[model samples]
Target: MIGVDWGTTSLRAYRIGASGPATDRLDRPGGILTVPQGGFPAALRDAIGPWLAAGETRVLLCGMVGSRQGWVEAPYLRCPAGPAEIAAATTAIPFAGAELRLIPGLTTEDEGGVPDVMRGEETKLVALAESLGTALACLPGTHSKWARLEDGRVTGFATHMTGETFAALSQHTILARTSVDGPDVPEAFSRGVDRARQPGGLLHHLFGARTLHLMGRLEQAETRSFLSGLLIGHEIVAAASGVTAVHLAGAAHLSALYAAALARNGIAVTQHDPDLVASGLRQIGRSLGWV
Candidate 1:
């Protein structure tokens, strides 16, 4: 079976064996947004054409590929959903030589009753639910998610635009002029996290980066990491209440940053590979009897 994690800016395909582990994988930058003239079919062919030619007959896809703006809208499943619920709602499409299935996203509400949703993260959550049973899981990205899973079901979740905000401020604001792109400075990052614990709140703390820079106390190269820590630190303080440990799933670099921030707050961290998307798609496929 071919498992595809087709997000907005990247496309990743994995060949899952009958037993479970992925046998091979493919990755490309031709995400939905990069597809030419809505040529999703062609893009898929370009990325995994050889795998299909090798006789792979079934495909399971997750992520933005199922978004309203994607190839086909697979609609979201309301929260308290699990792999069974996702499998039951899987949307199938027939390609030239294979059967393609798409997993639906998950949605839940905050304390204010405002709705929040996720697409690709649901697949990873399925894998997390199976492994951790009940836990708090964090998938940090452009829109980071803090999900609560109980007995293998996603009960509730919250979203924070930490990464997106960091990017915007670092690239589009005055902060950009003072920011430097380089490896994260742990000391600077930790200092930002410590500042987040203080009273003035995120908005006020955000300017602290600039103030320190102007005072020549914070070097230009460390500005970005400090800003990153401030945002991530505030995000954790605001969204990670009551959870003792967080199961982080995503790129190692981003997850490492979140893990460090969480650790400073007395939260233990268990990191999982972002590649769980492949295992997750396979699990859902088996549940649906489609593998």
Candidate 2:
């Protein structure tokens, strides 16, 4: 079996063998943006062609590759969606002489309003949500998502454009002009979170960073760290306001940053391996009878 978790930035393909696991796996950088409809076949060939075997391998994929902007659009399967529902809703897109089965993203309504949509993380979050009762699973990334789980099933969720906001502010806004990357000062981040938590002071506190830098209170080397803290802190304070226990999944460092911001605010959260996405895919695949 060929398993893939193709996201907006990269693709990972694993060749599962008879020995109880997937092996001979290959990973390559190929995002939907880099490969439009006309370019996806070549992208797939470059990533998984070497592992293909006629009639012996079945490929399963999930993520932005299922989005409208992808090689082929896969519509969302509405909620109460277990593995079967997701499989039943799949759209098959042929690529590289192989049939690629894409899992549908999810759509559900919540108190936050509107039907929330999620790709990639749905597989991972659902797979790891077995911990029992109304879990608040926050997947941190460029488009961070905070979802609700009940009895090991996804009920609803909210997407905070926090990471994207940070990127925009740091790269395009004034914050970018003095911000530095890399982990230099943890103190500045802690301070940023502190500022965001103050009552009715979030918007007011934002300007303080620039003021500090200008007034020579904060060093240029620490500006980026502060900006990261500001954005992450604001997000944590906003998203985690009422939730208690939570699971954060994604890149380790990014998760840690969120962990720090939320933990400081008394919200308990733990980080997990992203490989759970594959596990979710496998479970969803089995439910779909593909296994």
Give the Cα-based TM-score of candidate 1 against the true structure. 0.93
Model 2 collision count: 1
User: Where does candidate 2 have its weakest 10-residue lDDT segment?
Assistant: 16-25
lDDT of 2 at 224: 83
TM-score of each: 0.93, 0.88
Instruction: Tell me the tens digit of each residue's lDDT in model 1 across 1-291.
Output: 889999999999999875657889888887899877668888887888899999988888999999978999999999998888998998987678888888999989888999999999999888888888889999999899999999888999999998989999999888898877998899999888878888998888878899999999999989998998899999998988777899999888899899999999999999988777877887787787766
Clashing pairs in 2: 16-22
- Local accuracy of candidate 2 as per-residue lDDT tens digits, 70-130: 8778888777666667778888876645667898898888774677789877787667765
Which has the greatest lDDT? 1
* Residue 179 displacement (Å), model 2: 1.6
State, as a TM-score between 0 and 1, how close model 2 is to the true structure: 0.88
Best-fitting candidate, measured by TM-score?
Answer: 1
Clashes of each: 0, 1
C-alpha lDDT of residue 167 in model 1: 90
